[model samples]
Target: MNKHGIISLGEVIVDLIATDLSNTTFQRLLGGATVNVAVGVSRHGIPSYYLCKLGSDESSEFVKGQLTKEKVDLSFCSYDFNKEICSVYIHLNELGERYFHSYVNETPDEWITAEELDLEPFQKSKLFYFGSGTLFHPIARKTTEQAIHYAREENLKIAFDTNIRLKRWESENQCRETILSFVQKADIVKMTEDELLFLTETDTIETGLEHMAKLEIPYLFVTRGKDGAYAIHKNKIEHVPGIPVNAIDTTGAGDAFMAALLSRFHDNGVPNNEAELTEYTEFANKAGALSATKLGAL
Candidate 1:
């Protein structure tokens, strides 16, 4: 949390990815869009700071342990006395796709409100990253809002991933409205083709990028499973091919892609040409593919 590193503000939860919890053993992994990205960035050899509140609980310790194993900076992370784990169960379909089921009402990640958290880490960051997961709760939303404001004021690039967790929100309207609010604050917005349709209420990726463009966001990245990805910036568009992988679970592939892209951006400015964009996109595509080979998010 010192300075001059990437800062990720969002939830870090425990994900129990299992095809059948009753019959088979469930795999435990530290999951959550922001947390996954934080680990992804660190694994990419970037100085990444993961800012989230942990509880004085074993599950929280597991999250910290995962981050520590990845060598992520935890200077801005806090601990809550009344800590509880954000547990989620994931089911896989015939195609290896995942569906999440969560009964947890809350987690300690929301305890770090804007007023309580130290903004110095965010201020010193060259880029700030988040996702829609943080907006599920009011306390976490306030913290995310403050970080966005600070990132914009400092002219630091803001990276966002629209990770819609239906289990976390009470209503779709509430979720959609909050997602738009954060989208307006992001400099670069990353999401899936399906997420683009759901979040922006658009049928096509072009329309989603168009909506982001009108919001003054300079860049947009859309990852389309096996179809690869599309990138639009400054009215320029490019479609990058996807990498083929026998994916077992795509739990955090998109987050990994976001991390790879942000890591590239942190080291070098935005790609200025089709070639550069293609190279960057391919790099991110590999990162995402690598993630799918694993069971959990991070």
Candidate 2:
């Protein structure tokens, strides 16, 4: 149980990306925001641990091989033969923006339990990362909250992402409530402009920012599709311009950005000033931009 390490908790699914829309062909790959972050950190030369569950299917086995190949620590991962690995078909526009066509709603990823994972890892990790996807189901939400409770007790730094998948939740209100609940517990929160508006129940991005600032969220990052991203650093919001790239698919870009930001957190610790936070934001924006230059989470 090494202290000061990183650990990510969330879903790991098989992403069937539509590489050729005209031909209706697909390129299968393992992806999920949480999984992307795990791989992203490892790719950046950090040995991160992933906590999740796999199912009793071929896709699950493939996921195992990929995680092993990525050099991510899977000692805390669990498996179930009764369930099948979930999947999704993502459609991409010329802009590389994603439109998910279909998702396998049934998966064992959300069934994660506290007893299934070693609690020692939580105590040893310096930072904990999780997304809103796991809040879709009661079982998953309970498990995730239990882990969050542990992180809190250990005084581990927490980072949360508002990765809203409307299809996963029953209602928009439920999603909003859960989103706010998790963000409240995080030291830093990342969201797209749309997600920010949704959580704030505001009509404009400015209005949303105004409302969120009242919540006293220490640091915030809002991603704008092509306009790049904005960040609230030391109580001041600054816009970081986007890096131009002929993106192949923008599937895992945010995860890339987050992984880079958190890896920097691991390297230099959290920013104590606006200058330092802005520098980190710019670096993370570049990491996301570079990810869009390629396809898939890898």
How high a TM-score does candidate 1 get?
0.89
Name the top lDDT candidate: 2
lDDT of 1 at 28: 83
Residue pairs clashing in model 2 are none
lDDT of 1 by residue, 139-205 (tens): 8888888878888777789988888877668898898888888887788888888887887788877
Considering only N, C-alpha and C atoms within 3 Å, which residue pairs clash in candidate 1? none
User: Please, what is the TM-score per model?
Assistant: 0.89, 0.91
Whole-model alpha-carbon lDDT for candidate 1: 0.80
| TM-score of structure candidate 2 | 0.91
What's model 2's lDDT at 100? 74
Clashes of 1: 0
Give the 10-residue window scoring lowest on summed lDDT in candidate 2: 105-114
